[model samples]
Target: MQDNSPAQPAVDLRGVVKRFGTMTAVDHLDLTIRSGEFFTMLGASGCGKTTTLRLIAGFELPTEGQILISGQDVSDIPAYQRPVHTVFQSYALFPHLTILDNVAFPLRVRRLPRAEQRARAMAALEMVQMGRYGDRKPSQLSGGQQQRVALARALVNEPTVLLLDEPLGALDLKLRKEMQLELKDMQRRLGITFVFVTHDQEEALTLSDRIALMQGGRIVQLDTPANLYNAPQSLYAAEFIGETNLIPARMVSADHGSSVVEALGQTYRAEGTTASAGAAVTLALRPERVRREPAGTGPVGELVEIDFIGTDLRLTYRMADGSKVIVRQQNSGGIPPAIGERMPLGFETDSLRIFTS
Candidate 1:
């Protein structure tokens, strides 16, 4: 049969669902990944992120709904038959084969001519900056080199989409950071769709053009890194994307898109208006936004401890009501307050996010 799938939207999942016995792993999920875009699925373990990736790779069939690549349904298609490739976290290279052979294995399986396979393998190796190591066995290379070889093997197929499942999870911190940049660069140069799965929020924010935050088998939020960090839509999203301080507050009054909240026995004007009145709410504030001021100007608190974090300082203060609040200050110039010193903590009204609990 001639393949008549649309040559766009590298991947599209419509009402995708997967179940294991009585528990549903992926619940009625719908997603669309644009062609040539670097997309990421981020979530904790057992949140169905990997299951979604597996379903797209055809490693696991969905119980219901359709998986479309380029607009053609491939829900029941086997992994080997699909024009997709996966680079796993564990660099699954053949230890006995040379790097060149490992990269050429896929082409050989398709029975390509020897000359064509050799040329393609060398090119793939060069693309991953491993041309000189093509003659070396996978056992002889370092972890980073082996990972590059794995990536080269996946790229050699010239597949429509490349799925990476924590491909940098094995490398050291420095190497992982370097690889993140390299992978993004390679994706841009190749113009191929990349669906990356990672639980690290920093990695996702740094690498992906957009991220889908998964929670309990569903997508809680999907947006760019800046949007996800600056304006999270829910409590879970705010807490997950980065470090945040959640302060319990109550909406006392609101006017002209601004509301006043009573938090920690102090009334402060917040930026946004909420629908519910007399409701318990939480204000999401970043530690860096909380500023230290003179004791007489703002909320009074006693500095309990100061933590030196090399480039910054974290100050913990205890309010009269016995609530602990953390403030992160840059270590550029000003000397931090001594322990047991009294100070006023002031935060901008615009920085406060009022959300219903």
Candidate 2:
């Protein structure tokens, strides 16, 4: 007879809490990263994303709770003993060592034969497209090249999981974006669980299969990139993930799927929340989701300002009630709207997200 069970998570944090002297870094957090998935812990500085990554890497023990790696509880294990490797923002390569030697350093410490070490190190370097630079010193490589070497070092050990703590943070904007694509592609090829931490929202959305948007040492929302952007559960999630136009509103009627909201002296049926009728709420509207209409087709507003941002035009309008609405439309080589021109704006009901204040 055979019994079946689901595969264990690549990393699991069960009610994990980390506290410093008079300060709580990671609150009671429970999270599970699926095997071979690109998981990102994203938040601003001091939000415990780094601390959480440290805990998973066994750099810091949890004050309370357990951490499991590949179905084994390793909450108390030392960093070197865990089946995981970390790539830090600084790269931490030895300046004196050759690129191949730097990657082989881990194997050397484990007493692996020099031949095996070199073979494994070269293979890892090839995986990151840095094999040809094996003989160069760290100082001789560009920032992006050094980053790839660091990643190669981390991968040389063939760890069950890889933890990246903003590895691309040190690169310039253009190189950072280039590395973002490389990192995602590499992760896909390796099929190793990557636990990435970053404060950059765009980077997180770009590389992560799922993201945990953390605040105050706790996860505020955990979902795929698209879901986090399109269906943010709260205002913070909305404003943090992308630009949103927040408008003051009140719930006229609340239903399961849709609700009637009154805002800018007009009524609209939009996505609903748990808020009851007569509840004061906020409407989150994405600028690109808004539609500009004929002068009197919908609520009319005076275009106060227009900005040409490369591929898009940002238009700001002041409604009759003195509320401002911003719209972003693609620049299709058409005439621009003049300032002070009154035009009606319309948006689909489902595009508006209603959240109780």
Candidate 3:
């Protein structure tokens, strides 16, 4: 808190690196998190998302570089000394302590008065709607309730930043979705910076203001959910963020703000492609973007199978060139597909993303 720069970021990592023996867990990482930002670190297992989080939490000191909290360097500070609190997958609540005392644990550690601690703990529980259960033990609460109590405990400290390491990972599908919304709402209400680490793509996309997709100890892409999904810069990013068909294409023409490419045995115009003529590239098109043509008017592709996925239908069509194209059709007041010999698929020009090889 001592060091102040003009409008400093809430959390800043300057070329941060963490190594365990010969293996580097976090690479030369540089990140700046603005105040009240909900930044998520997303990746698969062993992709260093959690490690990067620990580096920020002061649980694991970086092997190199500096960590700044609100512009003050805190690289050498211990976890307890840092103005941050962590909520892990495991609730880690006290089994023997009452809910109120559990939430007040941090204040108790700081030697705060019992009256003030109780007041803060109750207020924290109220935020999570668990004030009624203040006298109950953690063992008496359900999984979701316990998780909320854990959140209450972490929030009672009112730290400069809140680090969540897959806190909703332990919940079931329904509960997890509910918790994701609740957590995001809480962050907005508190107006505190949140550094969340999760492997779940849907969770990251739904809750994060911006996501850092890490791979092999490095951030592969850092952007908003829509931008990362729509305009990925690389093949890995395009494929990893969501379901998209990557069609190999050759750029036949390039123009300002738009380009034409040959894909799937046909010519297609794409926008935002910067490839020169005759450049080989991968064209990304989402299944939802592919529209269905009237009976015989769409691309002539044999109907393979149609998957009825509740609200939407996914049609797998085999193109004439032996390549399969997946089409997502909305079940919106239209007759479903029948077993036909061939069907057609069309999409908008802007939906086609061109990535040069």
Candidate 4:
């Protein structure tokens, strides 16, 4: 499973697997992250994303396969010795110590000179925009500030990679978004590789240059955010990445590059290169892609409910065959249709995604 060549990856995992007794956590996972790139491992809880992050950080050893960091095999290396630092969700700062002391602790452990340690700690704090709050204890600072201190402590060591395990989870939504941008900017400025782990799809989509989506102890999909959203290879990937309406369909006919599916008592052609005729398939249509035409204008559906989601409206409808579908419309002009109203729901063939289940 070794990907041996002249081109070395910043982080590489080959045939990586972790098992707890009969339960397989991470199953034969393989991944490669380029230098100075922001990579995210995203999945639901118990999907082994956190375990994979720990394995890379040397906090846990793989039951099988190897892990390399900057071309060096560090599978057996201890967590402290690895040239990586992790920022945990729970800040893990010392409440008794001031921010400056907390950030300086790592340097102090290395026995650096007091003057040098203070200078480095201050510089790191400045990078996180927490230089002025160095005198305050963790308790005195807000959750976001404490997180900044934790980040400062991790960065003061100048590790080659920074592992963030849901570091922004404790912050409020607005603060969390602000920190996401800040963290991305900081990572770029430092030119250090970042391996972030989170279950939040929006966070991954915003921060990651590439995301490895895990499910059921395996990497189900790995791609750039755009590709993961636009062209999912599987039903699970499509449904997990965004809001998709999975309509039951059967492949009616197929050519070299396209196929027609019969769904909701209508035959619609979809653009997929490979799918067999007579195969049971599911059509993935994004909620935003569905257009509401004039009533009785095209394929008809009854709007059963409307949800006002601040900036947008979510309309739930039922097709002629009693299949439920959701459509997201921007709330620009006025209020949307009330319940029990019928509307024409139409989508282009290009916007449809066909997957064999």
- Clash number by candidate, in order: 0, 0, 3, 0
Writing each residue's lDDT as its tens digit, candidate 3 over 1-357 gives: 212434779999999999999998889999988888899999999999999889888889999999999989999999989999999789999999999999999999999999999999999999999999999999999999999999999999999999999999899999999999999999988988899999988889999888899999999999998888888767778788888887778999998667888887788888655788998988888888887776534457877898999898988888887878888878886777786657667866688878876
Pick the TM-score winner.
2
For model 1, the superposed segments whose C-alpha errors exceed 4 Å read 1-7, 254-257, 271-275
Q: Which one wins by lDDT: 1 or 3?
A: 1
Q: Model 1, range 1-357, lDDT digits (tens) per residue? A: 112434478899999999999999999999988888899999999889999999999999999999999878999899999989999889899989999999999999999999999999999999889999988998899999999999999999899999999899989999999999999999999988899999999999999888999999999998988888887878888889888888888888765567888888788887654746667888888888898888546677899999999899999999777877789999986776799988888877667888788
Give candidate 4's TM-score: 0.94
TM-score of each: 0.92, 0.95, 0.93, 0.94
RMSD in Å for all candidates: 3.9, 2.8, 3.2, 2.9
Worst 10 residues of 4 by lDDT: 1-10
What C-alpha root-mean-square deviation, in Å, does candidate 3 show against the real structure? 3.2
- Give Cα-based local distance difference scores for all models: 0.89, 0.91, 0.88, 0.88
TM-score of predicted structure 2: 0.95
Where model 4 places Cα greater than 4 Å from the true spot, the runs are 1-6, 272-275, 295-297
